[model samples]
Target: MLINKSFANQAGVSLIEILVTTLILGVGLLGVAALQISSLSSNQEGLFASQATAIAEDYASRVRSSKTSTVMPNTNISYAQFVAAYHNGNNAPLACAAAPAQLCRSDAGNAALDCTLAQLAIYDQWEVCSAAQEALPGGLVRVLNNGIRLTIVVDWDSEQGREDIGNVAVRNNNCSPLTGSNTRNCVILELVP
Candidate 1:
């Protein structure tokens, strides 16, 4: 029996076509995997930024509410004193573990032991700074008062391999960079309170 010439040629062409298709599919799948990895990295960066913003906003809100007469003394404690208490030299926050016993109370039993304005301010700073440290890797806080505006700066270490040097430089303009590393992320919030 003689095999048809057309049948032999068609069989060889089909095998070649399948091999080519598989190679293309493999390349496409690899591209998709890379895209997935990049997306996850971007999401993580966004989460860090969101956390920073929340921390700054929360502290600002605390300051705003602290302006009421109930929170501050009528004559002894000025708003300036409250603001001054938060001035950290761009360093890690003082440990809240040493916070005054009155400041840590959750029950009405401590209502008579009202925290002084200075102690309240310190407590607020500790609360915010501790949150930043816990939420972000290598996180830090700095409060700066330039006689006119108050600035709250929160910074943290950027994830490894995600450092865009140009972006880091731009983001850190108002805040100090992390020690020995240019790869840091920061958020700055300026407030009058």
Candidate 2:
């Protein structure tokens, strides 16, 4: 007869070792999940910023194209008027086939019929605000005129990291830097058109 004590002592795997391995793997997986969540939040913020920029540029370009005041003194169309139209707090519903919603429907390839300069100004502002609000969550548009300069401000709310942290206190201090209490984001574009 032969004695094999070493072979009997060596088991396949200990219960403590398996549990420790599982705990380490779980912790690693949790870290990966947290990273994924953070990446998504950052991506969403970038998306909102891009949308705001595009909206601002669209209005700026349109205003530049129609800089001349072709109408009379009472109906003179200017960028200032367009900006005011946006901030006037008038929520007139827009009905058009385009994304920005044109003032009048163009027939096929022909130009828009019976569209006046004043109408164009109002339409430009309406379209800009509509597109901005539709694209960004809790969107608000503001225009500031400083003699020779114009600043277009777009504000929107974000839920990034809010789910984990809690409710954030957003301040309306003219779009300044957001602290731990602030959750909203603002995009500012200044143009002299």
Candidate 3:
């Protein structure tokens, strides 16, 4: 009878253990939530870097294949003329390859200057810049021609939560940040295009 009476008086101990277990479980869940957030942010940063690199290379390839100064029989314009057209930025976007104007056509049937060489350069630029902006955030391209060499700089707005992305060197090389709000990421490529 004495032992039974003592056990019956200890019911409060079970309630205390349940409360402690619940507290520990809640803390563990909170930790997991924080980890998930960090992982997502890191993944976004990686994606931005990859996009910047690919876009820069795409423009480089286009410049190479569409060289203005080819000596082949099919190419009528000189390289100098092509470079000048690109620098002037006068060729507005158009469906040059279509009929009537027929400004751009690489097929064998097309005659010379169907689409002026400058028109081709402008079209290529628009295609590249448009693709970059669509794929990445606040994307911009800067092309510099220094007579002997060409530099292509691809810029995009830096993603938030990336403290290491922007530095003094990036600012020095690129005049503006990727976006107005944060440090801009710069992908610089040097070529003889």
Candidate 4:
């Protein structure tokens, strides 16, 4: 009778053990969830970075293929104009194997103009200027006579109603960075000719 009574008494888990197990399981689950969230956020951020890089490169290529004089300092190539010019092949003489305008054609050679200064490499954002307010993304220019440096900047937040995408210089050699998430991806391109 005593043995049977003792066995019954110890048949189940102790309250402290159960509590510890519950606490451990809860903590582990929370950690896993935090990890998942962080991973997902990182993935999204990577995608954004990729897109920014693509935009920057596209901008660089467009500038490369187009006539440099058209986009020189004090010129007024609006954002729309820039995009249109990029898509339209920049009036470059199409090669024999030229594809349609909608397709991104390659300009392996045949010559192209280089960028000028105000083309700083630091403050990397696209800007355009208007008569009333020059807060656009195309007013910045670099003045380089012997050599030219180019940086392609992407404006991911501009289309989303953000206010921090329009004040980068062409060279950006000396500028302070803003205190927030990065607003641009600057690819440095240099030309000497």
Candidate 5:
């Protein structure tokens, strides 16, 4: 074994060694910065996911609260009549059908074009029955209505890929997606409390 020189005894790193170390440090620093960026992006997505989940749960709870009194807005028509009109095989008049996808009174979204993450969230609802949701009352009126179903669908474009995830029906106190010129998405939740 040879004696080793202390750092004080050694004058300094050779130029070649210094260059190699600098290259290594530079690469390492870049890797760390990339990790930081990725972490921030992941955190942002988690926050959005939490917010979307809260929105979904809120609507679900609202449906549960008003299960018995799912009265349609039109006073003279009556709940049964509106529901029957809603459930019929033929598309109810445009007065009822919500928006794009032309899915009776429910699939309404921001506009004919938007399809935003928020809009997609409500648009993806599915029904429990063999028929389309349009064939049922535009909203789920049960706390855990087996006859109706909802799916909160969210989508966004990112460098990695397109993201689309949804939660199955959650009980609601009432239906909502209330008043708007762009009522399709709202109609999806309209009846919820």
Candidate 6:
């Protein structure tokens, strides 16, 4: 039986066709991998923002609770004074143990070494700042007051440069600490008492 020459030559895919097919598949896989990486980075950024929001909320609640009484018991110092104690900027945590003892009771071990209302405010700031630093990369906290309002600014390093979402600029001069670095992200929350 004689095989048709043309049919035999075209029976299977050529070597060049196989190589081209493999190259296309490899490029497609690489694109998928790039997309996966971008997705993971975005997820991480969202998580950090969520954490910052929660931290700011927690501190705001504490401040609100303190505003219940106009003046601290047994002291002329007012609620505004208490709020002012939290206006710290990247300062080292206050030494709670070194602070003067007062009526404000703490935990079991340090029940005797109680804190004053002002001391309590400082301690609260320290706790919030520590939380921010631990939960984020290069984290920092700034408590700012402009007489009528209180602002909590939580800053962290994004590793990669700024990510502009929805064509909105992430780095704004109004953000204070965030304006310095393109790689830094911040959550600013304002509370009015």
Q: For all the candidates, what are their Cα RMSDs to the real structure?
A: 5.0, 6.1, 7.1, 13.3, 13.7, 5.5
Q: For candidate 1, lDDT tens digit of each residue in 1-193?
A: 9998867776354777899999999999999988987776777778888998999898888777666743344667666666676665454444545545556324455553566666666777878888888898767666777665678777777754255422332244435432334567778889987
What order do candidates take by TM-score, descending?
1, 6, 2, 3, 4, 5
Q: What is the lDDT of residue 100 in candidate 3?
A: 36
Better of 2 and 5 by TM-score: 2
Candidate 2 lDDT over residue span 133-168, tens digit each: 788876666666655666777767765424453433
Clashes of 4: 22
What TM-score would every model get versus the actual structure?
A: 0.75, 0.69, 0.61, 0.42, 0.39, 0.74
* Candidates' C-alpha lDDT: 0.68, 0.64, 0.61, 0.36, 0.35, 0.67
In model 3, what is the error at residue 27, expressed in angstroms? 2.5
Query: Can you write out model 3's per-residue Cα lDDT over 52-131, one digit (the tens) per residue?
Result: 78877887787776673342344666656655655533222212232333435354775546445556666666666776
**Lowest lDDT 10-mer window, candidate 2?**
88-97
Candidate 6 residues lying further than 4 Å off, grouped into runs, are 1-8, 69-75, 89-114, 160-179
Q: Which runs in model 4 stand beyond 4 Å of their true positions?
A: 1-9, 67-147, 155-193
For candidate 5, the per-residue lDDT at 90 reads: 31
Model 1 CA lDDT for position 187: 83
Candidate 6 global CA lDDT score: 0.67
Q: How close is candidate 1 to the true structure, as a TM-score?
A: 0.75
Global lDDT of model 2: 0.64
Name the top lDDT candidate. Answer: 1
Relative to the true structure, candidate 4 reaches a TM of: 0.42
**Winning candidate number (TM-score):** 1
Model 6 RMSD in angstroms: 5.5
Error of 2 at 158 (Å): 1.7
Per-residue lDDT over 1-193 for candidate 6, one digit per residue giving the tens place of the 0 to 100 score: 9999889878688899999999999999999988986776677778888998998898898777666543445477755676676665343322333433343436467563445567667666666777877787767676777777877777777763234322222454555443366656788899885
